[model samples]
Target: MSENRKKNSALKVILIIILVVGLAVAWIGYRAFIASSIATSEEYFYVHTDEPYESVIKRIEDEGIVKNPSYFNYVARAMDLQTGIKPGRYKLSKDLSNRRFIGNLRGGYQEAVPFRFQNLRLKENFAGALGKNFEADSTTFLNLLNNEALAEKYGFNKDNFFLMFIPNTYEIYWNTKPEEIIDRFSKEYAKFWNADRKAKAAALNMTPEEVSVLASIVKGEALHVDEMPEIAGLYINRLKRGMLLQADPTVIFANNDFTIRRVLNRHLTIDNPYNTYRYKGLPPGPIMMPSIASIDAVLNYNQHEYIYMCAKDDFSGYHNFAKTVAEHQVNARKFQQALDARNIKK
Candidate 1:
């Protein structure tokens, strides 16, 4: 009975030891694989190209991307996460498991940023916008824009290169090269010029780029979307008649002083090609990023005899149209008088 009692005591001790060991193993497994690895609610992190695995791990730890980075390191090694890691922008959430976090990093599960642009007036402005949203440098974008070889390769000259960027939201990898971004824009530009749009441009006896330039003028002239077609027609008439565009917006752009409320005589005399008042027909390129509506308005221009327009005297953001110079002068006088009354000196 004594020996049996001793045997039962030994068995109990062994069973207790096993139970404690199993629980410890379970706890370790949970911490290493099942527990939430991300400390924050959310985080966006970047792994640079050719970055060492040690550096990547350090970034995760230093950036507070994980609740228990040591546990992450353990699971990461177990899954061989370092073997296939690639550079990208990745998102981490508290909901992510250690395994998932490591697995995602290994498989290059990345997030694409939405790049949006519209109504940007200058190439430099667009460069800043690109720099704000991507890993690309502003200087790189500017250099590409100024490169004649690049522009020619893309069916554009340096002057008209800005027209290639049709303003809209585009999903792109954050690490996309600046040149690759230009490629994406070229593709989007092609897509925007469908057969129907090309046919319309052809019927108007203008290239797509020319239409966009005219659209920019139409955009600048009217404050209302409804007025674009009529204003476009008036400009079309001037073009057909081989008259100078004499656009106030072009003069403002050439002067590079957007604060001018009233275009004065001095502003029109700037020896710049963009000064439409000094040059015949359209400017070299768009003075602003033309909206889709403005482009379509030019394509479907209103058939009218009016070749002149001036802002209405009431400042209603509409225009008074006229065919004869005498009538235009009368409209211009009323608008000029209104400007004088408002004290909008430029």
Candidate 2:
């Protein structure tokens, strides 16, 4: 009986050790599963140029894409990945291991797509267009360009600073902030305005603002690039002679509608700062987004004594230069005849 009791006691001790070991192993496995789940969860992530660690964590949490935001923050900080995450939209899974998550975040696993801008003009319009391609509010994007502080820094007044933003195709990451994009474009604009252009503008008694305004008018008026210098020359002559620019583009701008078949005599009487016909100078601002060709045309326009030009009837994509009102009237009549004959629906 004593031998049987001792054997029973030995068996009890062995069973207790096995049970403890099994519980410990199970606990470790469960912990590992939780950690892996948090790492791989389907969460939206983002990073920016100067995003703080707390903000990044909170942003991900607020997005409701993660199951455990704190876990992600802790793991990321532990692995020294607090600042390594790139700026872009990321797709994450809930079942990702911590190692895999960090690897993907820091390893540049995703190729960022690019967004572009082309021929943008109005501040609000530009903002709305950019908003369609990026993750920013349109109003905020516009207010920056219209900001007085940035304008003063860029050597332009509020009314004319918008022209400094040239309309060109710019490549940026798809998720780029509106502010960064604006900064990049503004920097490029500053580079474009060199000392030589500045000297030329000063010589013409025109500010950079006036040059850009004229360039935009020339861009919108002449369909052919070769005609730009001639158009510029005509406007420059008018400015020199104290004559009304009387540019039809200005009338179109004042009207806020560009599809006019022909400018009626009454359209010239519109009371707007942009109507060069009424205002004896250049428009208040640029009428359209001018290209580099147009800007160069204004900068290098040939000095001419002539004060008028009318479209040639030859359909040769050139204009008839007139030195007198009589000659200009004749050329204008000729152009009208050609339009009538071609049944050109303007």
Task: Give the top-scoring candidate (TM-score).
Answer: 1
Which parts of model 2 are misplaced by more than 4 Å? 1-104, 107-116, 148-150, 314-317, 341-346
Model 1 over residues 78-131: C-alpha lDDT tens digits?
999889888788887767888987777888898898888887888899998987
| Model 1 steric clash pairs | none
Candidate 2 vs. true structure, TM-score: 0.67
| Alpha carbon lDDT of each predicted model | 0.89, 0.75
Local accuracy of candidate 2 as per-residue lDDT tens digits, 1-346: 9999999999999999899999987765444334554533444455655667667667766866445655556566777777687556555665665556666667655435455554665667777877776667788777887888877776776777778777666666656776777778778887888899889888889987789899988887787888898789889989988999988888988988768756778788899998988899887778877778888888889878778887689887688889999999999999888888988755
Q: Which ten residues in a row have the lowest lDDT in candidate 1?
A: 36-45
Question: Candidate 1 overall Cα lDDT vs. reference?
Answer: 0.89
